[model samples]
Target: MAVDIRTQGLQKPVSVAEYLFARLYEIGIRSVHGVPGDFNLVALDFLPKAKLKWVGSVNELNAAYAADGYARTNGIGALITTFGVGELSAMNGIAGSFSEHVPVVHIVGCPSTVSQRNGMLLHHTLGNGDFSVFANMSSQVTCELAKLNKPAEIADQIDNALRECWIRSRPVYLMLPTDMVEKKIEGARLDQPIDLSEPPNDPEREDYVVDVVLRYLHAAKNPVMLVDACAIRHRVLGEVRDLIEKTKLPVFVTPMGKGAIDESSPTYGGVYAGTGSQPGVAERVESSDLVLSIGALKSDFNTTGFSYRTSQLKTIDFHSTHCVVRYSEYPGVTMRGVLRKVTERVDVGKLAKQHEVTKVVNEVAENRDSSDTITQAFFWPRVGEYLKENDIVVTETGTANFGIWETKYPRGVTGVTQILWGSIGWSLPAAQGAALAAKDMGVDRRTILFVGDGSFQLTCQEVAVMIRHNLKITIFLIYNEGFTIERFIHGMEAEYNDISRWQYTEVPTVFGASDKQVRKFIVKTKHELEKLLTDKEFNEAGGLQFVELWMPKEDAPRALRITTEVAARNNAKAE
Candidate 1:
């Protein structure tokens, strides 16, 4: 027999950057968002060859945020950065992706493997010559980490990390040394598509959990279903809709869970947030004999300071990785499987008649007094009317997050937020990313963003990127002087809560946007807002449109007031 020495598994040769970008393109990443750095410039050159577009951001942090927003809409997104300095700056955005369970592939181009091994001081690294510090920190927030050192192992490592990112619906990290970017790697693995299939559940455990859930589900006289953010993260919104349609049970969403289900469904009740829940929704959810919570994440903001009154014994929680029927837990049973089984097994038509809660009644009249000024009280309801079907709404963490909770979204309107992570200045870049994704996918949808003045200041530079790309986005800039949300939480009159005033309407011009490219409005009165809303040119604009609405510094949404009061009390105790 002839000695087989054909480099083992290597059937063809391709550069490392070529292989990486090819895999990303195969995984539905039409645009790779990031700022180019010295280390990543060479790799960036391969993007065009791979037939991928490079979305150059103003900075690394915004790049990561953009990637996250894209991932939420596009199913998967990828971002690239330079070594330590770049990666560290992008970590906060990565952590937000991790906390909210958005799948993003964070690729970092680093110093050569030889330099890392020899402990040579690199420009992006700390002067002490420790390059491993940043990677270790990233491991905490990422689901998986891969450092490409050997050519033979690089292809497998890349595939594994990207697979984990898709399967878990969370961010993953990949380090590509500068020298490795051009090195030839085996191309045979590229022929096989990345396996993103969810792991098979043990049949016995799946059957047991589903049966137990059905037993509790069918026995109760009054039952409710709560759909949450994880449902969106896990890409099971259709199955959730099926569960609702099949069971005919009243459905409600958590704060973070908003937009995961069709708000227009006849059985759709309202949002549930303990005391913060819509009228009668809390009573129904807490007092029900059985509550089926699918993909529920009971974070602080989602639960209204842990004020939920639902008894655990009456709850059957279906999580991403497991199912919990009261106190009994099934580890291998997933929400996806349980949802399918429930839709197939449950006899929803024969179940007892349940009271159907009407859709959220808008108390604000369509026609208000023209002389009245715009208030937080009047602003949100009007916004509800402005929303259209299939709009991708992005909200900032501060006032926008809480304020949007009260606004009733139309059917097919999807929501994006970082509520659990509570990061300010997140929505701006996120809007850009989402807009790019929507355009890239040929999906006809408008990207609307609600952000505060203070938060906007943090990442305002991304405005240029949006203008450069000519992305169609509508921005509602809530100008309340400073960090109104923070002041409400603590330091009501402190100087630390204040921010320098800027010409909010002139921001587009300052950021390289022309008058024709961006439609700008400064409205301090309700009449002006209403007129602007009705303007045909403003409504049908093909480019960016901005509205700066002025409100009192002390005013806030009802839910935000409640949450801030509790947070302030907690902070007082610490002091």
Candidate 2:
């Protein structure tokens, strides 16, 4: 029943690898991130020939992590890995990207189709002759999975999988056999671009949802607006901001939704996380008569151990694909569509302004001297002073993740963290990818990474990749002795929560960085950090820089401490 693609095409045939990379290049993927393996070597050779830069990473896991960072910044990103071991190693990173709604294409070069048909044992295989195990595992995490079985269907399969990735904002898997990489296929399809546009909204459904939202807004007193992570993921930040401006209501952002809105806005309230929220934020938000929550994700950590006290009956929730007004749910009513309508038609002048809540103030006090020991209380605020406009801030899970919430990000700065998945050691490689993405987009921005010593040890080698590519990245290494977050979660004094110590500042040198090009610092006191932040020459330096700041092992941010206590109690009850 399959129609032959060769019969109707007039153009000359192209290799499947060439065709795939060409399609990726046409669609804005300028670089491919991954490590080389035997199975993928044949396809990797076609990278530069396709006009795509081959960005080699330290490991497949870091490769995938880098690709995720790239995708979020560049709109779409890709990585290539080999069969079995290589692909399996990258699964965790891909899963994180899927959880966070990043668009990434995972192209896996697998064994040749001939070997699979003949049941030949391969070194990377499980020896039982089963080759589909990894792809099956990937299907659970990816939005779509395409295995190139027939040469004629190769182009169609590749194109379809990429389209799904763009539409869903999640990772997709494409498996290419070694022999199939060079198989002849029609090149005429290259002339036609893959449609990446979204389908038009259903007017009736959109109108109904928008009208329902407006009715709730008009009828209630003490109305409040809340923004979450989906506002950024679904590409509706501008619309959300417009709605906030038009309504002129008190607005607050969740921890996951940090940096999506201008925190400097007059109506901007502080972060709202129940008990973990900034002072007076929880009281104002929980007491609201009407809560209009957009792109809300009620994760335990995001909501401070499910601490949101807002009544569901008084809330209207907007999601990426649906709208929920109390108990009634309207499917196919996208938040993007609803926001557009609300921004265009709503008149906020008729709405009354209620008593204003005090703004959450998180400015850091100036350090007295260098001899003063650094603590989480003082360190976060000091780091805030170092931030500049348009900086892409990346934070690792654990202490750095929770600590950064205490620091107010500067205007024009964007924050990236894997809060939902809580993956450790993600920001290091992600910084490399983000820096590269910024460079590719021609955006002059610094990519800053905040990572704990324990987390840095997991994927520290990625710094070498950053250096090799001359990525403009500044790394702040928290030199707390061990796994501080785990200690707060369950075992406060347990030795099992500890990790081995290393010479943190010597990392860049060990990673093949030269002395003149790389700047390294180890600061134990508050004075050193302040001096470094104020140094114009150090701040304007190109290439890589590393700073090791020593803090107490048992110390953590106030929000982290509160959330962990709640988490501990929840865990005890579950057990």
Candidate 3:
């Protein structure tokens, strides 16, 4: 049913672009990221009118990655691109957002409806006059697709797509024909905010599931709580914390769930990724009689090559859309309500009597060697000590991602990684987006990034975007001379893993940052690294800081070493 604009007391009609941008502003998007193209150029004009800043990125792919990062921090993000070429270039990044459950609105400015009706050959198209091809490709990765052809229906379509993107926590594709940019739509519709609330779970079903969970939870002598990435993606940290604090159960996080829990908590155990767990973490988790797994995503990298020893018979899983009690499944019963109800109804006295709270002490290995060279074992722990609360840390897929497992974060810290997607060049642009978001939200949180030299080369130009926005980000570029993580897997000495060396410290200046606006450092020895880490001026620099930390080509994080070996064996077996 079409909504009658005149009946809604709407006297003025706004262009489709105006209506779209206004809705984005209402949803908390302050900055729009993308490149300028012929089709989207007019739509870009409406950004300023909507009180949205345009973050012109180096390319479409990086723009999508930045949108992913922005969405992670700002709650929701949007991007604008041209018809075919622009949207296709951003496919990989959009796919990453889909796989990792990030909410991003990918708006593509396409050809005019007249051009499409006549089957006109477009410059950015596949040269087949087939305009629907690109949108078809995007449909595979995006949760919702909105094609704006009619002015009357365009407003509703945009609202529905954005609603789906937010509620599902995934990317959505919006195709706006160039001709529709000026087509007037009902502006009064913007007065009503899109309903962003998650649908309430069935009350009766929720009660039954909560009872089943409590029965197992109270019956087990050894019960533990395991947290994972979906907990953060689905916005259930508060509920998870409530359950943990009320129950006082031993809480552990998986690798992808690094920053999900406050590590400073007394009952907080270290990361547990099966055999890749910290010291005794695997033993404690696997031996538990009842394991309450919250928002668990058991990916290969997250589980250390599928090495979880915990049995399904002993586990009860809490998910965003469903709950599982051992082998029985309850669909549509989300964790947000269940966890909250469980925390309220759980018998704290009975739990305390049934199980003894075991404090898992996180022990960092000391630098036994008197040599001045920096090692992975020493660097990660030292970095952990340097990190402050509420900091945003972005790590690349290779070594930095796995190395972060050893670095216990402070309370309130947020981690950004692509373990499931494993995109190499994601963190640089992501860090830029995160820093920009922090600035926009007026939060004093510092944005930090850790990227390998090989991965950095892929999207190093994004540093220019950071400089353009004057984001105060700290970047630690590991100079290992090659892909260290790949070497551990199969290419121990392959030339394909090697990368050309560059003066990494000179990047900020080349990226248009003034000397006062940037700080650069090169640390080879342990002494040099320690001095830089402790320097108050370096830590509190008013502008961007880039450090080239030199490590041996062969050295890799302990967790990375084990997981890669397992991956190699699996690949060989498949061959």
Give model 2's TM-score versus the native structure: 0.96
Output the TM-score of candidate 3. 0.97
Candidate 1 has its poorest 10 consecutive residues by lDDT at 1-10
The digit string of per-residue lDDT tens for model 3 on 1-575 reads: 99755435545688899999999999899999999999999999988999999999999999999999998888889899999889988999999999999999999999999999988987998888898999999999999999999886898999999999988999999999999998888887887899999999999999999999988888888899999989989899999998888888898999888899999888887898998886578888998999999989999899999999999999999998899999999999999999999999998877744344454433445643788888888888778888999999999998899888888799999999999999889999999999999999999998999999999999999999999999989999999998888899978899999999899999888888888888889999988998998999877756799999999999998889999998998888943
What C-alpha lDDT values do all the predictions have? Answer: 0.87, 0.86, 0.90
Predicted candidate 2 versus true structure: per-residue lDDT over 1-575, tens digit per residue: 87656644637688899899999998888888998999999999899899899998899999999998898778889999999999999999999999988889999999999999887888989998888989999998999999997987888998999888987888999999999998878888898999987665799989988898888887788989899888777778888888887888899889888888776788888788888887589889998989989888788888889989999899999887788998889987788888889878776765666676578756675433444888887877677778887788998888877877777777878888888988888889988898899988888899989999888999999988988888889898998888888899988788888888898888889888898768998888777777888888778747788988889888899889999998899888943
Query: What TM-score would every model get versus the actual structure?
Result: 0.97, 0.96, 0.97
**Candidates ranked, most accurate by lDDT first:** 3, 1, 2
Q: Tell me how many clashing residue pairs each candidate has.
A: 0, 1, 0
Q: For every candidate structure, what is the RMSD over all alpha carbons to the true structure, in angstroms? A: 2.4, 2.6, 2.5
Q: Least accurate stretch of 10 residues (summed lDDT) in model 3?
A: 354-363
Q: Pairs clashing in candidate 2?
A: 370-527
Candidate 2 ranges with C-alpha deviation above 4 Å: 1-8, 354-357, 366-371
